[model samples]
Target chain A: MERLWNTHIIEVGFDKIVEFFYRMSEVADKLRQEGLYFRYGPERLPEIIRIPERGTLRVKYGFPIFQKYGVCMDVTNVEQALIAEEAGATSVMVLDKLPYDVRSSGGIARMASINRIREVMDNVTIPVMAKVRIGHYMEARILEALGIDMIDESEVLTPADEERHINKWLFKVPFVNGARNLGEALRRIYEGASMIRTKGEAGTGNVAEAVKHMRTLMNEVMVLTFMSPEDRMKKAREYGVPYELVDLVSHLRRLPVVNFAAGGIATPADAALMMWLGADGVFVGSGIFKSQDPHIRAEAIVLATSMWWSPDIVLEAQSMIDEAKSMMGIDIRKLKPEELLQVRGV
Target chain B: MKVGILAYQGGVDEHRYMVVEACKELSISCEVVNVVEKHSASNIDALIIPGGESTTILKLMKRFGVDEVIRKSIENGLPVMGTCAGAILLAKRVKDLKTGRVLQGTLETLDMLVIRNFYGRQRESFEIDLDIQVLGEKPFRGIFIRSPAIVEVGQGVEVMARYGESYVLVRQGKVFASTFHPELSGDTRLHKYFIEFVKR
Candidate 1:
């Protein structure tokens, strides 16, 4: 019955996080203020948790993972996750969009890709994640069935058979969505998306202005309907809420949904800003990959992520982090890595 | 400020958003209020009852407190806007949604044929361009979310707006009503129109 349900947008009064929580809790006893929505504490974004030099222990409130020196990485390979861990990433977002026909390739199919992700999960002690598309609830459920931590419910990609494919709210799995604006983001949360990532207007390398725009918009909307920032955080904390994507979805009751911010994060300062703007964690992509000092920047990101949430403990890494050397050395023309080509946005 | 939106409980978000958006676009402060609240009438500068389950709204509003405040507000000339269930509330004689008893509420404010739940069920919700006579310019893109139809208009009632065969929008003094949700109708011209009417 839940699979084919499509919701027509309706306007209600101010989004009532508490009222919604109460209503939903009344319906589902397990959620009785249980708030089984987000991964709390410092281990939230375990992808970058193991960065060797950049791993700091600073923590921020509300975001999924804002530690003193938070560590996170985007990886197609397990080894890269290790490197990110060594550099200081708590969690690694696995973003190799599996080929539409994984069976066509002898190496691995999309389903098998999850197996490989599982291997990475096995190798790492921290939480790991993979991406899925809207309406692809089956694959997402299967991913959750395999015990992979969180699924990035990406909007940019979908092999959905039809628009009638309902939201993942019906499933027992945790779902996340990447949204550029607040209204839609909150809607996704209500629909059972556990995680929320910043849309970041992908493909465009421009970061500063776009990220700031997102933060400003969210700030206004959140403040308009709910308690002040400090009070909201305290309440969320009192409820044992992570105020992360997964938590917001589980707590959906016409309230301000909590989610980690992602996309267009290009600097440690940007990572810091996401925390400042109420993000639970930061997904650093172009910022880490395109930095002049890749290793240093990556380390800086991990450090900044952790410290951004805390007033104390600024990043002062002792070990020399590898600045991601110019990728010009890797002969992209020589090697036929289609994944790299996709990143080129050609 | 405790802005009462008729939680007709069918599809409330659209109307809630329209008013919120209008206030946002116009920089006026507002919030969705329960018309059922006893305190809402005196507390709010205005009221909007969105398009929704008329039977549910009528019964619930009365069970709650919307019926009283509405009459009190109209008597005091406080601005009250009804779209669909809201429109029904402004009617002098509403066919008691359940018993079909044509009972009278305080509303003799507008002259119009008010039909209850004219747009059948949920499957009938639709969208169409409306030529709102009051705007005197561009048409209002009416997004009818389970809308009722205004079957007729009385003499004093200015047929301010219509979509094809149905009177989608209308107004009367401090009491403005529409069969379709003008608040949900994407265009702020109606909200702006209400604001202008209220201000004047």
Candidate 2:
């Protein structure tokens, strides 16, 4: 055994053998903790794994989408996806079941089927995004391999892990994550989320939670602007995010990434309200699909989001949809604690 | 001077911000307006077509009757600049890179042939620094997001920059177009150059 050890060390060198064993231990440790590890050859790891320079991913992915499309509509099939594109949506999010359906039919919600996503992608000329359950890195990988424009490590879908999230930095495709406040936004940005959206009570068709979350986030940012450097550092620690990010937020008076309001935005008025409250954009899920006229409602919401600053245009947009045709809203307060999707990833 | 940003869709704010910054640097008084309708399009001293979804912007422009106004303004020698999708709109010919067919309904102001999504999808988007003599000795960092590429330019068009064999920036008469977004780069040189053209 001693002779064999000496021969092996001589052939591969002590440093290389030690590194090999150390890497193997890491893999074993990861397997034990997470139940799986994507194995790649050591030489090719650097090329496969990427750490985005600060703000690069956001500039390349998030900013373009935010600037181009003030509204991202959710769709379940090829027809809805086409309607979304036709209605002038800048982007569309694909789902196996719309948020309303997810809320109605209680089950383990995962990423949409690959074929379904492909069908949507094939049908639409606009950018196609889809959601993967929180911490489901394998599903993220599949989406990335499928050439998805963006991935949402979303709370709308059932989380795969209770306490962890997919390390977004590992993927080439930009990710959008849901955050309820400044801390969550910064944390997701630190974790390499290129975009951040408010985690309102999705599928409820009630914009109150969405409004509350946006107000909280913006108000927190306002508070940060008044803090001293030392107080800011303390706040950063309290938020469990990097002080640098906190500093950036304080100086910029906004989240460094593109922030969109999502969850329970059901009407043109609701969409305009979020935009007026300072969302770069918005995401409508059940709001459009569950409405009386999905096509007209979608166009109205798009117009409202884009022209939120102009009251007359917003009024025009509001008149395009009928309130009676809107989705029946749920009182978020009535939902049990376990039924909340917003609290899942948080 | 008043500048109109074709604000129906896409990076409208970014261009407005950059143009304002450029004006400040040049000590020129400029008012930026969102050209949502025909009147706004007609009243501008200069126009900017921002980087966005070309089809969406085209649809909105036609819907609001801003497309004809813009076409007429350019015909009357209005200094205009377009980036990415904006560049696609200005091109005389636009070909879809995926389908290898001509895309119709662009403003067709600039004398160039642009291929849409020449660099593939979002995952294939990139950023790079280019040497443009017009912008002086410094390398301008170009942010390209699913950017188009200028495959051909007419006799009147002057190529300003190139990435590989394709033209990324071009100019003909008073029209300027770039396949990569200059507004996102936070560099004001391109904006300044266009401002100078407008000034002239």
Candidate 3:
């Protein structure tokens, strides 16, 4: 062991160690020039931030969705983002239009303006997520350059590509996409999505589709969990995702990524019910703003989400919202097949 | 045993998940307290300050009066465990690594002095297996994210663990602070250890 150690030390050589220090000193000198001071021994060594040179992204840079009952609110502007922060939202999804506005505006809903996203980023302390068109790589690039926390390749934002989704593996930050079933969820995971949300009917202010999607996804996962390896492989092939992802879902019996319920959550009870149905969290947009009191309703939704297991707390949360004042919720049955956002992405 | 997590800011979900998991393993009851206001801090056996951006957390804590409430609660025997940014807030003094300026809004609950971003910037953030003797022979995986380093400690402070030559975890009475995030480490030992500490 001692001989091997000496041989290892000799092979390492003093010159390489000196060269390492030389490069380190160069970096330190640059940092010194930058006016940043160091606290420990020697001079303040300016650190060279390690940038990944190659390989598949580790899904490290996205907003953390492992939060217990995280509340993700959809905000169109800075004021709403601030209100979300005040209301205990774990993160805010910045978009140009909520589903309500999208349904009513009847125009091509694209990514929110860069200036608007910037204003929200500057004013907020919590993680800020923005949406890009389903296949608009440039919009995702712009959001990435702006140092946005997460990007949603959303169908609600009008599909930028008809046949393909953004290659999420190409980006440094994480992408979240909506999935209507286990296959869609797994496909998105194979595409490098770090988080998944149910592609429920947006702006509808109803929770049926969200519930349906979550149920369908979970039930499918259970079936996959019980399948044989060959069967799972066949299912993976059928779903157009890798077998490894399918294997992971089989073992975990759930989506490998954080699964959240989004699109039509309108009340605190609606949020809690989604949580009880195995959703990691819920995302609300028109629900809070379209209510009698956004401040109270927002806080109530956040409360119900966090205390989902407790019926009494959920009841308390329910009492805070005025049911009559909620947004005019559109039933999923009324929506024509062409208007279904869930059917947009793969 | 009932434990509370300060959920108004920073890794609220991550910490709550880990702590709740810890409580489940330990077979104890736990509650996540969203410390958006002073009253929110009441009625918990212990409190956990999760990792996140320290300045923003401090600013929010002060704005919502959670800082004072936490101070009083800790004074009144509420055992607290602060990780990463939480450690910075608990320190008596926080120094900026860039300018060596004393940053404001610290709760001064812990006796140590900390230097922010001592582990470097976000890009330099990393994870490593640490030898914390208290956690037995197994190396504790410490996740350091824009983490600070505890450079100095008062006479009352006890060094719980270290990485290299710097102190990473320290305790002063019921107050425990760690410069690394245990919640993100996927290890339950630290949470279990903290829960045991809280139980005592």
Candidate 4:
């Protein structure tokens, strides 16, 4: 009764590159078995395909690590993780230093200790994610080896590379990258990120930056909906991503991967605001543990996030904790341009 | 017509968005039923169980006493649709993947047995196009994310759609269940179908 509908089809060109790699590796294995070297001369080598500096690519694997409306809390130890789990957090993001402490303490930030990560993973039934320095493939590999559920190539950590970021397509574990704009999101997607988080000036507790970033990304997507195919192709060329991916964004009217809001989210209201703005969820870092009532705040954020559509539920969540006992708000404007975590990658 | 989406837990937003889109297309009224305790069969023309963690949803459903209410309402001819984890809760029997332990608390509205995560874990999740007869010649892209699979179907249950012989979408009178997420597919045909089903 129906003709073929082509409007919803999505073509991810990077998938072809991944398939090519698989083929090359298989061919190399065959050659090695015959005691031969299969080598392509520079002239015969496959032309290097250029990816747009900031275009979204199709994600290969999607492990539902976090449930919809679930909160992924940032924890530094097993106890906080367990607390988060008990409070209804779907997942926990293990970190060596909470963003607020990182800003105040000002030092070389790095990945959390493997031993601590293992302890947290051992205790929590929920998924455990950890952070690695941006562009640090080795750290990502180590996290993967330790069997981390997900890895955040975070801007919160001191970036390891200046020119390039970690190539996530090579890993078995999924990666979550932070973005402040559509181009940055697209570029990270091209790099094979399974999840995207708004890098909203971490440790601020203001929620303004998170709102701005989310609106900016969504607005950019909204603009794409009205553009002509030729204009979209032109935009794709400008963004440096495959036209198919751009087209997919146009059709879906949202990012293909799970998009979360992070960086400055603090209260139940803050979490609810992000959900209303179309974030898949919210990541509370210094927000919960930094507050006076970690347990109540954690539980409240989870409830507020899940029942975001209800203002009465949000009000109840807000009433559960005191705002004065929460983490001191930092004016994002006061932070120098170099101190901003969102500006690290791209 | 007023459609109620069960909003106790997981993937609630996606369902709300898709259902709202479907309503707009059909020009019908819609509301998200968060307080399951307060929801009555008379007020809701139909209900949608959104995807999420089945265990958590089951526990909450029990706590709020929504489980008994929903099960009874469905028995009384209340139209309902369950997707992903929702499908597992709607099945007659649910078994744990590794422990082989049988867990129950499902609505048992659909006359079938489902194995949680039968296809595989989250990393193994995938999307495939399927030829659903009722939806016409256009194939529906089913998004399977750690979804359950129907292992057995009882009498009176009609298998409406499948992905390569695997039972993914099934219907039993007023009850509908799908192993994949049609809401996230950015296609409202399934939602439209449900709304049309409600109108009838």
Name model 3 segments beyond 4 Å from true.
Answer: A1-62, B1-79, B84-108, B111-168, B187-200
Residues A152-174, model 3: lDDT tens digits: 89989889998898877667666
Instruction: State which candidate has the highest lDDT.
Output: 2
Candidate 2 chain B, which ten residues in sequence have the lowest lDDT sum?
Answer: B96-105
RMSD of each: 23.9, 12.0, 12.5, 8.7
> How close to the true structure is residue B75 of candidate 3, measured as C-alpha lDDT?
90
| C-alpha TM-scores of all predictions | 0.41, 0.87, 0.72, 0.71
All candidates: interface RMSD:
24.5, 15.6, 13.0, 9.7
Ranking by lDDT: 2, 4, 3, 1
Ordered from best to worst DockQ, the candidate numbers read: 2, 4, 3, 1
Deviation (Å) of B17 in candidate 3: 8.3
Q: Write the per-residue lDDT of candidate 3 for residues B16-122, one digit (tens) a residue.
A: 66777778898987665556556768878888887765654565567557788889888998899998878988999988675466767688989888997675533
Best DockQ among the predictions, by candidate number:
2
lDDT of 1 by residue, A1-346 (tens): 1101111123332223324433453434444348654421112122222221111111001112111124446666677666665564656666563221121233422333666786676555334667665566677777766765556665434435334333554543345566655545555555555456666533223354346545654553444345555655554454443344324432332234335556556566666666666554567654555445665667666555544533342234213234243221222234344422122110
Stretches of candidate 2 off by over 4 Å are A1-69, B99-103
The ten-residue window of minimal lDDT in model 1 chain A covers A53-62
For candidate 4, write residues B1-200 as lDDT tens digits. 77777766666656766777778888886665443455543468888888777765665567557888888778788999999878988998988564465766678778898987676544455566776899888877676766788978999999989876579999999899998888766679999999899889
RMSD of 3: 12.5
Of 1 and 4, the candidate ahead on TM-score is: 4
Q: Which stretches in model 4 have alpha-carbon errors above 4 Å?
A: A1-66, A118-123, A144-147, A223-238, A242-253, A333-336, B1-3, B8-37, B40-42, B55-68, B91-121, B126-144, B148-200
